[model samples]
Target: MPKSKNKFGKYLLIFWGLFITPFLLLIIIMFMASKGWIGEQLPSFEELENPKSNLASEVISSDQNVLGKYYVENRTNIHYYDLSQNVVNALKATEDIRFEDHSGIDPKGLLRAVFRAGKAGGGSTITQQLAKNLFHEKPDTKTERVIQKLQEWIIAIQLERRYTKEEIIAMYLNTVEFSSNAYGIKSASRTYFNQTPDSLSVQEAAVLIGMLQAPTRFNPARNPDRALARRNIVLSQMNKYDFISDEHIDSIIALPIELNFQVEDHNFGLATYFRESLRNDLLKWCKEHINNATGKPYNLYTDGLKIYTTIDSRMQRYAEEAMREHMTEIQKKFTEHWKNKEPWEDHREILEEGKKRSDRYIRMKAAGASTKQIDSAFAAKTKMQLFSWKGDIDTIISPMDSIKYFKKMLQLGFMSMEPQSGYIRAWVGGNDYRYFQYDHVKEGKRQVGSTFKPFLYTLAMQEGYSPCYKIPNIRVTFDLPTGDQWSPVNADGKYGGMLTLKEGLAESVNAISAYLMKQFGPQAMIEIARKMGITSPIDPVPAICLGTPDVSVFEMVGAYSTFANKGVWTQPIYLTRIEDKNGNILQEFVPRKVEAISEETAYLMLSLMQGVVQFGTGGRLRGQYKLGMPIAGKTGTTQNQSDGWFMGITPELVSGCWVGCEDRLVHFRTLELGQGARTAMPIWALYMQKLYADKSLNLYKGDFEAPKDPLNVILDCDKYVQPGDNKTSFDRDF
Candidate 1:
């Protein structure tokens, strides 16, 4: 009996040992998993900060004063909202109805997913999708996929512990890629339909949610049929789960998956030209700053930055409309002319063919066509077949087509700024931004023509030349340093022998400007121009007075802005401030000012410029457009009419307009068949008319004071004395 009892005890002990051994092994496995020795571990917050991690802080618009995007009104991103109840409900019903109730793994969903993968191939859960987007490296394999699943499970549990179910859903919506270049629901909505996420209809929301399965395959923009099919599946799922009423699900499914299909206006209010100019300027400034620091090229586009710009949306639209209307009129006229002659095909087609022929001829010349050969070619029968037969033969010889072509060429850009505050108010960079990206307003460097005369006048004034002092506008040739005798002529080609300093400037007399340069000495004029914000190097030559220097519209605009701002010059600035995601200011732009001219001198100069608008070449603008304030401006035409320019100012705004080809070739038509005032000025005037429609905004004018220096007064008189005038008041001193 004792032996039988001992046998029973041994059997009992062995069975107990078997049960306890399995529990011990299970504990060891769980500990190993927790320690990440046997499987992938969950990512901690510190792991997210690892240098090798692909994740980076998201960039947001730095504009604080404006809500949402600075330009777009009433548009808000998903990031701005803190997990709205509707959003959470929508996502839960659409993505995973059992998400909150399940552990890291959903058993029924997993089993179903495995069966679907075996049949229709790949399937992923929300955790798996998040792992793919946030953590998994590419070039995927079975091993990598397995590891990813393990990591996802671990991370999903960690996420569940750290964040509420609503927060996880919010982050998922924000991070998921819905379509090409559309990383979040907000961007996806904007890119596909030009609507905000919150504004999305039930149908639209379902379509976006449907994209979760296969974004590219179900992209409504690309595959409408597939998108609709996927959307119906989501609607059915919502109905099956009782998340939405059966009637509502049926109604949603029956509704057409009609997309608004409104594209985002990347141009931003017809200011594409201005945007391009601003972009180029910003790029250049960024590059220069980077080069100075690191001696290497830096691409501003890739750098995460907030670039504030100087464009006024209202002014920009007005400028674009004016330019388009005027140019379209010209284009219509040309088209009509071509149609009247051809009568068989589209006039634009004929014009295009003619352009090609002209281009070939130019190429031939560049490739080495001798003068005699070119003349012979022009006289040949083959030339008629190739060039003259194409379109209006007169277009080659007359400036009409050239003018129309340059206007159509749309190379000109105009920019205006408030010199005192460096506030850029108006900009017209190109006729169309789609065709031409080079912004003449900021990047183009063309000869200033006679518009630069003011600098010479300013120098003469600083040296004691008064506006009332008379000077000779007679035909005179000067022996240049290069031994070439340079003879300057007036706009009308007739010398007005003796004229007051005011008349000389008002008339834009080239001879008078040249004479002033010689009298004041080129070095002094250079100094004055430099001081007034003309950064382009000026040649110390007599022709410099006649505006021989090549200056950018930006430089000229800034210089004129000084004259507008009571002689205080401020650097043109675009950005106001930059801030990080936490609202910490990274950079702030402060307006920098320098005294370019005395307030008295600036007022006097402005008075003379007003005469230019009232009586000179720019006077035509007054007749065409009613400017409600005291206006000062200058009109400039280069030699051979290659460049046409107008720089004008009111007390409130300073603007510069330039019209010319990229090449220095003469190509434009004028009212007098001679100047830019007739062609470019009309464009400028049209833009300004729309700009100043608000009567509340008027020019700021104040009292002017004369200089106190006796020597300055004497010098002003001496420098401005007209030729043949024997009023030698200072002769005794000499």
Candidate 2:
């Protein structure tokens, strides 16, 4: 019996040793991993606790320190507020009521979570979650998650020691991503509900808070039913937790979810393009600044830098609405034609069919359809397929119906600056940022068309050509450097025999402009353009009289603003101030001014442009929208109708509009459709009407005084003198 007992005890001891050895090894390995003594050393608590060491310093500026930029709200039409009390309360009820009381991890919740997870549990407090969101690096594996959780706990404790309860909540609200693109509650409130956080109702707040649990699954915009269910659960939790009264919960549940389709501060239309262009410019500035100092790339998006822009939120919304309305009208007209031919049965489907037919034709052409030959019998059948055929064989039908097609075409930008301060008031790059990111106002280098005529005429006035100087309007052609002949023609292709300088300008007479260009010389015109702030290339050819110089709407607006500002040219700037996150002033853009044109010369040009609008191609604008204020503008159309442009200005604002295909193809089907007065003037007029609807503007009715003769101001023009004594020549000219 004693021998049997000893053998049994040895067997039991062996079995126990086998079972406990692996567990003991596992514990030692876990301890080593936790202490970062394993294969690759993991980050320690000391490293994770110091968020500032890892954080990049963000540059912020005070409102006064920024230059050439405006502190426009995300959406100016609506007001914005920080996280509301109700929103905070709802979040507490739904997420963690003990958020303030708990440490980095909740003990009871961790216990329950551990039981549920078995081996993959996360025991994070609200503070821990905030810390993870704000500072923790992204992790993909279970082990990595555990490491991140540990780091998160260390960071959370540090945060608790540094910030108060309310400040932590505020930071979480500002930092948490409620949706895919939405980074914070402020953005989410504006995006989903189109309301300020403070303005959100109980139900709306609950719905938004519920989205924190699972954004994609309960996105109110995409899944309203799921969102409602989630919201109800949140509301029930709120009631259970006594965060809100039962009656309040019932009322919240009864209330329907109302969505505002118009998102605030969304920067619809050309704002996106302008914003992107501005972003690129800003990035370049940042990179250049960094390159000069540290030779490193600075990421503007992730750097948490506050970017103040020059976009006028109101103007942006109006521009977007106008484009949408115009496109809709065009579509409606096209649809009406189709409807009149056939009763409406599904216009979209019919439109799709038309598109398919067009695509097929294009494909056939691309595949060398022109080379194919067909017998007469086969040709007839092929025609029937190519074009829809009627029941009567005599009447050939078209295979494709013509559906209305309105190209998503829009290019409009504005650069408004205070005449004295040079602060840019507003700017829009284009109609849709998604389609085109180039800022036509700032970067688009197209033929100024007729918009450059004013600068030439202004130069003429400055160089001794009176507004009343007689210039023959006879037909004239010039030889190009490439051995090609170029003849400028009027809009009607008719030459007016004799015209005064003022008459030539008012009528946009190409022959008279070309004649003046010859008299004044090309170099003089180029110099005038340069003085007027046209930075683009100017070909000193006769065509320059008709505005063939390549320039941007931004430059054009700034040049015209010289006329508005009584001859002082101010560079457009948007930001007024910039500060650091710690409220230190970083930069300030001071307004600067340069005199480009004399007050008298500017007034003369303004008068001529006003006449052009009143009696020339832009007459329609004056007739349609009886602008109460005295406004001056010029309309321009390029050859083959490839580009249409307009630059208009009031004493208070200067705006430019251009319309054409990006590919530079002929746009209009006919001459009636080709003019800038037809394409761009209407958009400008509409924008002006909206801008000056209720505002009172002072009108300038003063006349421009003309010089006595062209010889008085001619610079070193001894070559043009008649062969006579100097005294005799001067006396004769006078």
Candidate 3:
């Protein structure tokens, strides 16, 4: 009996060695692989602790709204709490039914996957899937693939040990791709439903979870039918797992995937132009500033920065709406103004010049095409989407005609800023950013027209000239260095009356402006303008006072803000602060302040400009819009009515607007429809009206504040004013 027992024990030892030895060997191999001691490289322990992800940098508005993002992957991470219970449950039910019970790997599912050769399931737990994504690489050989699978299992176990189940799931959701350039659940939720992750409904959660299987095949926006079917499958799984009741799932699957789809794109959204402009600025800033942790320059696209800007979402909406409203009206009138005759017909040279500047022409030229070939390309009709006031128009048109169409179409730039802080509240760079890539606010340099007068007038105020300073409306000729005479032509060509300086500016009298220009030569005008924040080069020609030089809307707005800011030129700034991914404040920006003029001079200029809105060219602000606020403004109409500009100021805000065709040659024949007061001022009025209606903004409606000290200079012309006592005081009397 002892011999028989010994034989059985020997046989048992043999059986244990036959099975357990290879299993232990496999375990050892996997352990070595996890430690990077085997077939394929795996993430190190530290790397596993914090997985790499390409996160988008966000642009947040002053109201805490996300204006847009700069990204290679449009991803923003959220903690476990930011995800709704619906998403969590849906994930577990569909992807891993025994998620809570498993420690990285499930024994039954793994055995099923092995014996059935993955026909039943891949048996990849959520943690394993996350491990694959965290350290993704392609295997060239089947042997490498098998080793990679082993490495994934070991890495999954490590992740499970290092993090809680909730953290594992959160990381999985945060790093997964959801198509449409949207990586991670937060961006997916906002891109599909325009909602936060925590606000997703059960159906929405199910839809997003279903997309994880195959993002493109089940994209809600692109493949709604497949997405709906997949979503129902997820819901059915939820019912099987008892996460959702049978009755609940029946109703849930019956519901279609209702998506408010908006692709996360730099060319689409609230502030496309501003985001593009900020991207350029941030690129420079990143080069200048380095990241302390990595000892490298910051990456604007991948570093996951939070740029807090001064833009107000509400105000941006209003500004965009105002542009669309007024631009449509003026464009229609302009079309009718030159109904039969093209504005550029007499100057086909201008058309030829513009045609050469086109992308088609440039491409053809680069391809070594002859001039005739380039012309042929332009004249060839193709399917294209043209920008229109109503909406984008899909049509078959020649590229040349497309250019002409856009050339005839109007473009504009509008911006509003807080004068005291120089915080930009709203900026609309063009009619449509996708079609017109130029940013008129910062990048575009065009004739400012009569908007340039403020700088000269500022000099007049500094030289002790009061608002009541009078001059005759006569042709003031300048003796040119070329031995010729130069004189400005008034629109009406009527010059006789003696008008006050305030009246002359309000009326935008060319002769009076030329008279002032002669007194203070172009040199002094340039000096005052530079001090007022005009960065553009100013020509010292006498014609500069007539707005001949080109300047940007950004410079104009910043220069005009000096008056409202009580003579301090606060540089217009967009960003308030920048933060890292972890919400650590990296840098804060403050507006640069410079004393451009005296408080008294600024006040006097305000009084003179106020007459513009009260009775001069900008009188439409009072008559048409009936804006009750005490406003100071100027109206500018460039040569041939090519460009129209309105510079307006209130106590709290300084706003500017410019309207023109793409080519300076394309313009209205009549000043009535194209003048600054008619074209540009209407937009400002409409924007201000909306701003005032929204009482939450609390824009100042009161009159401009006077100087703190006693006024040494006079504004009242009727008083014993040296300029126009009226022989009585117009400044005080008004």
Candidate with maximal lDDT? 3
> Which wins on lDDT, candidate 2 or candidate 3?
3
For candidate 1, give the lDDT of residue 307: 49
Candidate 1 lDDT over residue span 119-148, tens digit each: 542334454455455565663688655555
Give the per-residue lDDT of model 3 (tens digit) for 1-734. Answer: 99999999999986676556447757877577567665347677778776888889999999999999988899998999999999999999999989999889877677667557789689899999998888868789998777777778778888999999999999999989999989999999999999999999999999999999999999999999999999988888889989898767677778877889898898888988998899999999999989885789999988899999999999999999999999999889988887777788878887788788888788878889998888888889999999989899999999888877878888999999999999999999998888999999999989999888878888888887778777888998999989999989888888897888898889888888898898989999998999999989887999998898899999999999999888999999999999999899999999999999999889888998999988899988888798889899999999989999999998999999999988898988888888998889999999999999998987767778887788866666666454333454434422
The local lDDT score (0 to 100) that residue 318 gets in candidate 2 is: 54
Pairs clashing within candidate 3: 716-731, 717-730, 717-731, 718-728, 718-729, 718-730, 719-728, 719-729
TM-score of 2: 0.72
Top TM-score hit: 3
C-alpha-based local distance difference test score of model 1: 0.63
CA lDDT of every candidate: 0.63, 0.62, 0.88
TM-score winner between candidates 2 and 3: 3
lDDT of 2: 0.62
Relative to the unseen true structure, what is the C-alpha lDDT of residue 642 in candidate 3, on a scale of 0 to 100?
90
Better of 1 and 2 by TM-score: 1
Which regions of candidate 2 deviate over 4 angstroms? Answer: 1-81, 103-123, 135-154, 260-270, 291-297, 323-431, 436-439, 476-487, 493-498, 575-585, 590-592, 663-665, 694-734
Writing each residue's lDDT as its tens digit, candidate 2 over 1-734 gives 99999999999986676566446655765675677654243334553442321112222122222212222222111112366777888887876777877765566666555456645434566788788766666888998776566556556776787777776776667656666466567667867876768878778888888888788898888888998999988889889989779767787787667776433232442355555566666767667544222246544543334455444555555555554454344334334434444332433454444444455555765666552321122233223321111111333433333222222233455454444555554565665553345677787777778777887788877765655556667877777889998877777787656576667777778888777776777888888777767788876777888887778877787777788777888887665554433345545666567888877677667777877777777777778877666667888888766677878776667777776644354255355665777767777777766666534322233433333343342222343343243644331222
lDDT (C-alpha) at residue 270 in model 2 = 36
